[model samples]
Target: MLYQVALPLIPQVGGGTARTLVNYLGTPEAVFSAPKDRLAKIPRIGEVLVRSILANKEAALRQAEEVILRAEKEEVQLLYYTNTAYPDRLRDLPDAPLLLYYKGTANLNAPKVISIVGTRKSTEYGRVVTEQLVQDLVKHNALVVSGLAYGIDIISHRAALKEGLSTIGVMANSLETIYPTVHTRDAERMLQQGGLLSEFPFGTKPDAPRFPSRNRIIAGMADCTIVVESTSKGGSLISADIAHSYDREVMAVPGPITSETSQGCNQLIKSLKAVPYTRAKDLEELLNWDKALAPASLPKPVPALDLSGFPAEQQQVLRVLQQAGPTHIDVLSRHTQFTMGQLSSVLFTLEMSGLVKGMPGKLYGLV
Candidate 1:
């Protein structure tokens, strides 16, 4: 535990470098015990970084011990990346944090996970959408994930609690300090239904640079990311980008074209970078929620066009999905003899028409 926690603290040894070292050396303890000459010869270790690790080894070990003690006192759980209890989705990321300090009852590996993020200065529309989306997710038994910031992040947590769903707040700082300090009460409430999680250890301040790293956990822990509101640029957008890079489902709530907070969502949709999230069922369908759960969450059935009304090409696609059940987009195209781009447009129309649902891993099925 000491070596695992201390490895990432060594100067110049980031998550990626630590992972590389651990991968090559078999363990964090092995990396530290390897001879200086042997460490210097590892692909990217080089002599300078090896010397830095060697020089800081004692101090890092001390820091690690202090963190372990703090965890005991504060009731924090130290989740090593290799631990089975650590979030499985997050472990898939190449640069995933080596250590996480978690305090909460909610399972990090909850079957259904989705992050809702937006601007700290979110507008009323954003709040309403966030609340409704979180409430709707209850039927799917989803765990709402957010950054625990002002506006949409806190709103997401509160809505999840109100709806009796689990929610996780990924913190940029250590468990010892809540940044902005305003959400401390909300964090306390979250412990009942969810919890606050951080990759930083005790005594670590919530600095600006630490946020992007925190954002990854928010992005990586979930199966998808939803940006409720954002300007042209912000941390929420960063989270969306990271989630997309991880090949997770990305959705955006569209706002008025002129609203500053809506620009990011509009851009994401306009560029086809993210799906246009107009209703909660958009998420439900995209995530492939069980058919039985839909009736409980949705107010009404998705309005689907009769098979006779759809163009013959779309009807053909639907017929294939009906017969094949859930099938990959590539398989759909091959069976229907449609080109990839052509099949995509057909599927999009069918999806918007409520006849088809898209699943993760590029699979599609009838709604």
Candidate 2:
């Protein structure tokens, strides 16, 4: 399966063209066996790729055999791209891997899946959301997918592991090695829960260019790709774009507009290009997920800010702020634990206390 397909793929320029030829030729074996003159006439069968395919016949066969033996010993299932079990969504893509080496029990064709992506410099917001959203997805029968990068990517994968959820990690490197090196333990755990996936064969080192192509597969495999956070330019958005091209759902969570890391998501929402989702529920509603949940809800933002020591006034203020986004001091007081007259005094005191800040809308936040 990989040999004939690989011939066309190696040429770089004609990779897509060769993939198309295989689509028409029916199978790699058939393509390889076709009469030379007959194969030559096909557009873009170009001499280079055709000759490579013809010349590498023995090497391809030996490689395939070795691959099968390795998979069998490791208990990994080796799937040809054309196999019925090959992910239908992925198979449709132009650069889909010619073969997949998978471990674990989750179906590649699972009914619900979403890719979680973000930057290496994950903020508090990205980490919180990725952890929460992945837990939520797993509870609702959705498998989590990610690139296994640091920060948001690994946060999502680790959360899935904690939740006892199956997860998949797409890699920019070949199966022979780990890219970050630090995440090898996490990757090992993932092999038990899900599997590692990549288009590159063994010994392909992680490269700068491979990341963009790698990101596309992460996006293409999922029903939707959720960017926990990204800058105005990064691989996550590139993946999002490919997901959109594949007609998959693209949803982004909004963040403070000032942060360069979140600008991409906010821009996506503003353009009315991707769905805006703040919490796990937002994703579920968009995907129309209906399933039982076993995991705990996301931990509160202020886990250590226990209100136990606070008086009713502060507690009430926090409660009101929870219902509202950020609240004005006077309005927060009026809505809870004080009259309008008392509210002004509390507002002044709270302002002096430095627990909150004023915004144009009279809104306040816990500083």
Candidate 3:
């Protein structure tokens, strides 16, 4: 655990690099202990990063120990990328944080997760739409995620709480303090239902640059990201863009063209970057949440598949998909225990064979 926490602290060691080191060297501790010559030989581990690892080993471990102690004192959970508790949605994302500081009881991998994001300067219409959307989502038993900033973010969280739904607030700063201090009380209330999550460790301030990094987490951790309102530019649009890049479902509320706050959403719709969100039903249809939430007894028994002609890997993927209905690639990888490369190859073959179809948000289902 100490080595897991320390690996990310080394400068220039992003999530992808850290994963590569762990994959090649066998473990974080092994990566730290490897000789400089050996480390340099690994792909992409240049002289500078190798030197940084060797020079900062002890300091990084010390910092990691302190971080662990503070996290314990604050009752925050340290979610390493490889930990079982870590979010699977983020597990395969190239830029996902290697470590997260989470304080909450809600399941991070809830079957239905949606992030609602928008401008800090929100209008009454935005608030109403956000609240109504959350309320309607209660029937689907969805978990809500948001940045917990002012305006629509807070409105969504509060609405989720009122609707008896769990809602997670992704933070740009550490768990030690909530930004926009006014939301502190609301955040505290969330600890009982959902909770606050952050990639930043304790004492890390909410600097300007950290918010965009924070936005990626919000985008990566959910199946869909909905922008309720925004101007031509704002953090919410940034979150939407990040979500789109991740191949996650992105939705934008269509507001009046005359309204300044609607410009960003209108532009996204015009560009075909996002679907127009009018109500919760749009989300349900996009994500197939209605079918997912249907009573287990109601599903028709799947007919046995004749997979004899397919390769073993393809057969395995088909069986899982048959049982799981629409599944994300990450989930398929976990169930099949296939590496991404192997899973992609098998899925590609099945797709070309007309046995599988791709769905929104990187999901795959029977054709």
Best by TM-score: 3
lDDT of each: 0.86, 0.72, 0.90
Highest lDDT scorer: 3
* TM-score of each model, paired residue for residue: 0.81, 0.72, 0.93
- What digit string (tens of lDDT, one per residue) describes model 1 on residues 1-367? 9899899888888778899899898999998788888898789778889889889998999988988888889899999887877997787467788888899999998878899999999999999999888877877789999988998998999899889998999998888787779888888888888998998877788889989989989988987899999999877999989988876789999999989999999998888878988887787777666454645663444345467877889988988887777886645765897866788899999889777888764788888
Ranking by lDDT: 3, 1, 2
lDDT of 3 by residue, 1-367 (tens): 8999999988888888999899899999998889988998999889999989999999999999999998899899999988888888888888888888999989998888999999999999999999999988898788899998999999999999999999999999998888989999999999999999998867889999989999999999998899999999777989999998877889999999999999999999999999999976688778877666667775566677888987788889999988888888878988998977898899888889898998865789987
Against the hidden true structure, what lDDT does model 2 obtain?
0.72
**How much is the lDDT of residue 348 in candidate 3?**
86
Candidate 3 whole-model C-alpha lDDT, 0 to 1: 0.90
- Give the Å error, residue 87, model 1: 0.5
CA-RMSD of model 3? 2.1
Q: Any runs in candidate 2 off by more than 4 Å, and if so which?
A: 1-19, 290-367
Over the full model, what C-alpha lDDT does candidate 1 score relative to the true structure?
A: 0.86
